[model samples]
Target: MLYAILAYHVEDEILSWSPEQDAAVVAKVIEVQAPMRASGLLGPAARLDETRKARTLRGPGAGMVLDGPFSETKEQLLGFHLVDCATDDEAVAAARKLRAVNPSAVYEIRPVKLYVPADGFGTTRG
Candidate 1:
């Protein structure tokens, strides 16, 4: 199964870190991800920019385009990791490893739901 591990942290607190501090934290993240990558369980992952650079759109159709993130929370989604795990336990274990490196951050793991085509046609199976 495919799982998405969402990383959340206080944007202000992170931005306040010195360059050296930031680099050290990122280095630890890389170290934790290395084994997962070698195991072929890691997929696409990336760190997002601050909410100030984000744009939110809501309402009907294209809706109204707004500045910043949709939510007004101190904690923001900082990044995500896509992993292929055999069970929920395995996915949780991956999240645990990440937490070990950065205890201040929060990780939310969710299973991915893949769409399957039916009868070799364009129809999709729910």
Candidate 2:
């Protein structure tokens, strides 16, 4: 099964990190992911840009365009990692490894139903 591990953090706190601090945190995360990556359990991962640059399209037919994210929570969705695992326990263990590196961030793990267009986008994961 494939899982999505969502990373959430306070936007303000993350934004406050200096370049060096950011690099150090990222390095730690990479270190934790090394084994998983080598084992082919880890797939794609990404860190999103600041929310201030985000645009939201909502309402009927998703026609309305709004500035910034629509979340009211203190923490924002900072990024995600796509991982392949045999069981829920395996996925949770992967999240635990990530949490050990960045204890301040929150991780939400969920199973994924993937789809890829047939017009050359790629193959589906079903």
Candidate 3:
């Protein structure tokens, strides 16, 4: 199964962490990724640009492409990791290792829902 490990910022994350501190965390991320890769668990990982670069589209017909940064929030998502694990224990272990690398960070580990192809009758079948 696939697990997504989400890391979001907390009160102290942006306020207290300096560039150097952030860099150290990034370095640890690198180390962790190496092990994850060796174990054949890591799928993809990325750090998003500030929310200022975001654009939201409500629907296809509106031609309404909203622009600009999202309203600021305290717990902005920082990044995530996608891991393929055989069991919950393995997924938790990976998340714990990441948490240990950066104690100040918070994470949410969740299972990825498997997608089923839609049946011809306009509905999805299991």
Candidate 4:
């Protein structure tokens, strides 16, 4: 099964980190991911740009373009990791590893409903 580990953190708290602190955190993240990557369980992962750079679009159809994220909250979606695991426990373990490195952040683990493309290229969730 595939799982999405969504990371949430306060933008201000992250921004307050010094350059060395940021580097240390990133190094720890890489260290924690090493085993998962070696096991071929880790997939796409990335840290999102600050929320200030985000643009939200709302309304009907394509929707009216907005200036920022759709919702306001103390914590923002900061990053995500896509992992393939054999069981829920395995996925949760991956989340735990991530949380250990980013102690101040929260992680939401969700099973993925993968989109498979057909001959015509339409998406079907599986």
The TM-score of predicted model 1 comes to 0.85
TM-score of each: 0.85, 0.86, 0.72, 0.86
Candidate 2 lDDT by residue in tens digits, 22-64 = 9999999999888999999888788999988889888898488
Give the deviation of candidate 1 from the true structure as CA RMSD. Answer: 7.3
Best by lDDT: 2
What is model 3's C-alpha RMSD? 8.7
Model 1, runs deviating above 4 Å: 114-126
Ranking by lDDT: 2, 1, 4, 3
Candidate models: Cα lDDT each = 0.89, 0.90, 0.77, 0.89
Checking candidate 1 for backbone clashes, the offending pairs are none
lDDT of 4 by residue, 2-115 (tens): 999999998899999999999999999999999899999897778999998999878999898878885567999989999999999989999999999889998989999983
Ten consecutive residues with minimal summed lDDT in candidate 3?
Answer: 115-124
Q: Global CA lDDT of candidate 1, please?
A: 0.89
Per-prediction CA RMSD (Å)? 7.3, 4.9, 8.7, 6.0
Q: Against the correct fold, how does model 4 do in TM-score?
A: 0.86
